[model samples]
Target: MRARLKRLLPRTLFGRSVLIIVTPLIVLQAVALQIFYGTHWEVVSRRLAAAVAGDIAMIVEMLARHPGEETLAWVTREAFARLELVIRLEPGAVLPEEPDPRTGPAEAELAAALAERVRLPFRIAWPRTERAVEIAVQLPDGLLHVEAPAKRLFTGTVTVFVIWLIGSALILFAVAVLFMNNQVKPIRRLAAAAEAFGKGQDVAPIKPEGAEEVRLAAASFNRMRERIARFLAQRTEMLAGVSHDLRTPITRMRLGLAMLTPRLGEEDRAEAAALERDLAEMEAMIEAYLAFARGEGAEQAQPADLAELIEEVARKARRNGAVVTVEAEPSLVVPLRVDAMRRCLTNLVDNARRHAAHVWLGAARSVRPSGGAAVQITVDDDGPGIPPEQREHAFRPFVRLGATAGAGGTGLGLSIARDIVRAHGGEIALEESPRGGLRARISLPA
Candidate 1:
């Protein structure tokens, strides 16, 4: 049953909003109407009956002015035509008895209203009909019994109440929709804030300006973001300082080795050459750290064809004797931080080249099954593939396996590439390539 209701719900925000607002209003108004009928219906009917009794009193007061009983009855019927009013008097009490059953439905309704009261509009019911001879039976203390038809009076009162209920529900529904929209605004703002944070973009603190819970959520999110930003800043500063200092000492060592190049023995020269190789590797590691540690770049997003970017990266790899091929369709533009995305794609292609003899780059625009345009770019290589367990593990910074450690990588390449792609609202994954090697699949917005 819950599943059925979920399926029936409107898929769009506006439709859901309208349904949420209107459904509760209709139910509440219906409940209120039932309550009103249960508690106050008798009171309203009694007040109406009392007014009818007053009119009947006036009729009795002016009865002497009439020429006869027949004329007086005619006058009474005409006066109470629209309302279910009854008039029957008992000996100088100056009020009507309850309506006679022989009369109409209106009279019976008026008579029923006085059923509980004594010495007022007297008791009335439909014990018998068809005998138009209206009876004025005597009760204790000069009370008179009266009866009339009940069906018409019941119908008339119900009609009026139903009209009132419908109008009240409509007015209430309008007010509810307005308030619901206002209440939902903060939720929408919170969602947008989360999306911005996901993209590594700066989201301004949303003042929880709605209900107490919404305000609390916004405050919590803002506080968490501030703490994360501070942490990232301090960590990046420390790494940058260490890398810079290490590079200075290494530069001095490289110069000292150069100064001894002429006097060094064959084995000593070989050791010095190996030391130079170590220095170069350290330099590369520092460069990788600098690139990977950077956060969201303050570049304006612009539409660019991801296929074109992949092709350019592959072309650069080809010039360096790497057999990289690109296959893609053109004119598929998506919003991107161009510089960061370029670095990310270049690193992935470069990694492929270092791993495999043949690199193939392919791009295609695909849509997610749940609905969203996704651009898929793949870099496949024909090298020994990583195990399934290690595929995801290798994407982390500074994690190197047995074979990859000697491959001249800082191990930050894949991690930095994944980070940059995620910042653009995209993802990267590793899978078995057709070449029996690793295939890197990157998905971005289209």
Candidate 2:
């Protein structure tokens, strides 16, 4: 039951805060109404009813004491003029067998008061037509009929109380909504800043505002961002230095091997050629390492035509003697780091070209189940696909499959591509393609 109620609740801080504030307020109002009607209003009605009944009883007693027709007529005329009551002396009238079904607190109080003050039997009628109460009291001579305004007995304080209570509740709710919205706004800005940072987009520093907790959170986020930036900078600089130091020696070794090759015997020449191949491989590995370390170099995100980017990648692959085809929506623009995205796609296409004769590149817009829009880029190839178990292994840096290790390249391509994609708040997955080979799918928020 608790879980179901949680599911039914609003899924935002502002909405839930409003619910938290308004629910208790409504309950308190309802309890207040109950107390008013059950205790306070009932007491007030009874007191009012008793006061009206007392007036009626006094007039009846005055009529009884007068006894003469002329004196009774004078008493009736004064009562009507002063008390706003209509009194009549009926000689042969009879009371009804049953009273009205809508008997209430005022009627009960009036009946109790009349019973105490008057000696004779009486009947009361609440006639709807005139909105008044009619009382028939039996005197020794005849029946004394009385009509009093119903409003005299019941003053409708309940209606006024309800109106005030509802008006106050609505005002309280409006104030609560305004305050909650203001409180949640800072949290929303904090979340957006974090999201943009995660996507490798530069965001302005967020000013600490709102409550102390919210300000503290914003401060912490800013500190974490600075720390991460510093760490990435230090790491990139260190790796760049290592790569630069190693490259000079490697180049000298290549030059030395070229200079000495012509003077070597046949066996020595073969050995020198093997050394040259190793040096070349070493150079390639160092370049790949540096490329991965640099992380595409502080590229700013801008709106770029993704379809054109894919077409350009395909065209480059084709120029390199690979069969490449592209299917993309034209003029499909998305916010991306153009150089980083281009490098990432080039790596995937190159990896595909090395292993497969035919490569298929495609891009299209997609919508997530959670109602977010995204763009999906697919690179499919007709090569020997990695096994399901080894697919994840392919994404790790410097790790190559024994079967495909002789393809003449360092195994950092997929790793670098994945790093770049993930930096943009996107994901890459490997699956079996329709061409019976590997399929690399990248999904990025549009």
Query: Which candidate achieves the best TM-score against the true structure?
Result: 2
Q: What are the per-residue Cα lDDT tens digits for candidate 1 across 226-276?
A: 998898888878977987798899899999989987799999999999999
TM-score of each: 0.67, 0.77
The residue pairs that clash in candidate 2, if any, are none
- Estimate, for each residue in 396-428, the C-alpha lDDT of model 2 and write its tens digit: 999888667988779999999999999888899
Let me know the TM-score candidate 2 reaches against the reference structure: 0.77
Model 1 worst lDDT run, 10 consecutive residues: 131-140
- lDDT (Cα, 0-100) at 441 in candidate 1: 92
The RMSD (Cα, Å) of candidate 2 is 5.3
Residue 392, candidate 1: alpha-carbon lDDT: 90
**366, model 1: CA deviation in Å?**
1.7
